[model samples]
Target: MTLQTTSAERVRTSFDKQGMLRAIGATLTDVRPGSVTIELRPGPSNRQQHGYVHAGAVSAIADTAAGYAAQTLMPEGRTVLTTEFKINLLAPAVGDRLVATGEVIKAGRTLTVAQSKVYALSGENQRLIALLSATLIAVDHVED
Candidate 1:
């Protein structure tokens, strides 16, 4: 589907309102018509038993990216919510930072499909840490 709004700033504004992202220190790095990238510098607080980033953290970012990617294509006054997602952890997430990139595969009137890839970045190297596929539903925002 064609983009309804390609305003990156608007997308960033919406992204900034997500309190979970703030709590996790995730930053919206890139926003495009059907894609978004989020970066996170995981601290000790986000690590698990083996000193690796927790699986939940990885999934959270991936999910957020995919949801945002679908939102980017939604018409004005509409918002998207994740209906379902499946994620696979491919590798241990140990690195200086993690980057999640989401791209929309299909955009429908009510439903959109997106895929996300999470990479663990250490120095100049990046390792694939997880992959996610999500289905999002678009709903009209009701303003009070």
Candidate 2:
């Protein structure tokens, strides 16, 4: 069954508030029902000892993407949080740009399961860098 999205703009707005994404220069490329994509241009600040993008950074983007993807399917006034995730680093993240795509596998009342894949993009080439499976929990947004 296909899940309907309530507000893509709201999701984008929430994503914009993430300081980590801003610090890493990540952009929200797409947002749809049960799916979202984030892209980042790797720079010196994000590189590891071998000049590759840090694994933590890669995982961060993947995790954020997954959480947001699940959030896209949630009702209005609901916020999503990452409960947990497991990731596998498959290849060295060496490229001009890194893209992470997340899609919801199952959407439940409280918990949603999502999967994300990170790819390193060079000119005309894309290499798989990592994969992640995550669980997200929905919570009511409280107005203070």
Candidate 3:
């Protein structure tokens, strides 16, 4: 695993120490200069109608990915929060694990834009689960 410097690492570190990351069952898979990947497996509690992963769950994954991707480009000690996002459910969530890959398209002083694609690993083939576009804003928090 290559951990290229991430702008949000400082914030993620604090969040990790506070055990907030565990709430979503998310962990960093790959963190690099402009890209980030977050992995999650839909457990029993994440299922919705028809015994499949809920759309809400999928949306959360995308949001996480996009936020982290944006964070990778910010200055150290800065944290990012989602400002706006839009997601399109491309296909059914049919897989053992869901991988959300996000890349920063634009990074600015206050706002960042990211694009994400979610894939479900189904045996030998990967299926497209969702597509997301999001904007995040970097903020300074006094709480340490």
Candidate 4:
């Protein structure tokens, strides 16, 4: 795959679209350096016929969190995009809310590698439902 080089380091910036979506209606709740947490409430919109959250939603949240986690370590003028990802659904996502936490594993000159774990949060303990990993590419887009 064709990827951008990580030369001419740029200033770091927040992800506009991502922040907006998460701020408005997205289930994502918290984010920090090398980590993110997303929540998915059990509802008709997010659930399957079997009364469990859809796998796609699980993946989407995990990917977004992982991508943003990678973004947190990039320089200014540089942005991150997920180049590839994989998710392994482990258990039935049956709970009130699903929380996905992502952490960066490797940050390279051109790519950031991260992993996320999805948990079905109960009252006190959480159950592991999915595991996700992604390779994020850093791009320095110039504006005139």
**Which candidate tops TM-score?**
2
User: Across residues 16-126, which tens digit of lDDT does each residue of candidate 3 receive?
Assistant: 653434654666677677777877787766678787778887888788778877877776557788999999999888688889999999999898999999999977889
lDDT at position 137, candidate 4: 93
Worst 10 residues of 1 by lDDT: 1-10
Instruction: Indicate which candidate wins on lDDT.
Output: 2
Candidate 3 local distance difference test against the native: 0.78
Q: Each candidate's lDDT (Cα)? A: 0.87, 0.88, 0.78, 0.73
Between which residue pairs do clashes occur in model 2?
Answer: none
Report the lDDT tens digits of candidate 1 across residue range 1-144: 234344566688788788877887789998888899999898876777888888888988999999888888777888888999999999998888999999999999999999999999999999999999999999887452
Better of 2 and 4 by TM-score: 2
Runs in model 1 with CA error above 4 Å? Answer: 1-6, 142-144
Query: In terms of TM-score, how similar is model 1 to the real structure?
Result: 0.91
Q: Which stretches of candidate 4 lie over 4 Å from their true place?
A: 1-25, 141-144
Clashes of each: 0, 0, 0, 6
lDDT of 2 by residue, 1-144 (tens): 233433788777788788988887788999988889999889876778998889988998899889989988887788888889999999998898999999999999999999999999999999999999999999998552
Candidate 3 stretches greater than 4 Å from native: 1-24, 142-144
TM-score of each: 0.91, 0.93, 0.85, 0.79
Candidate 2 has an lDDT of: 0.88
Better TM-score candidate (3, 4): 3
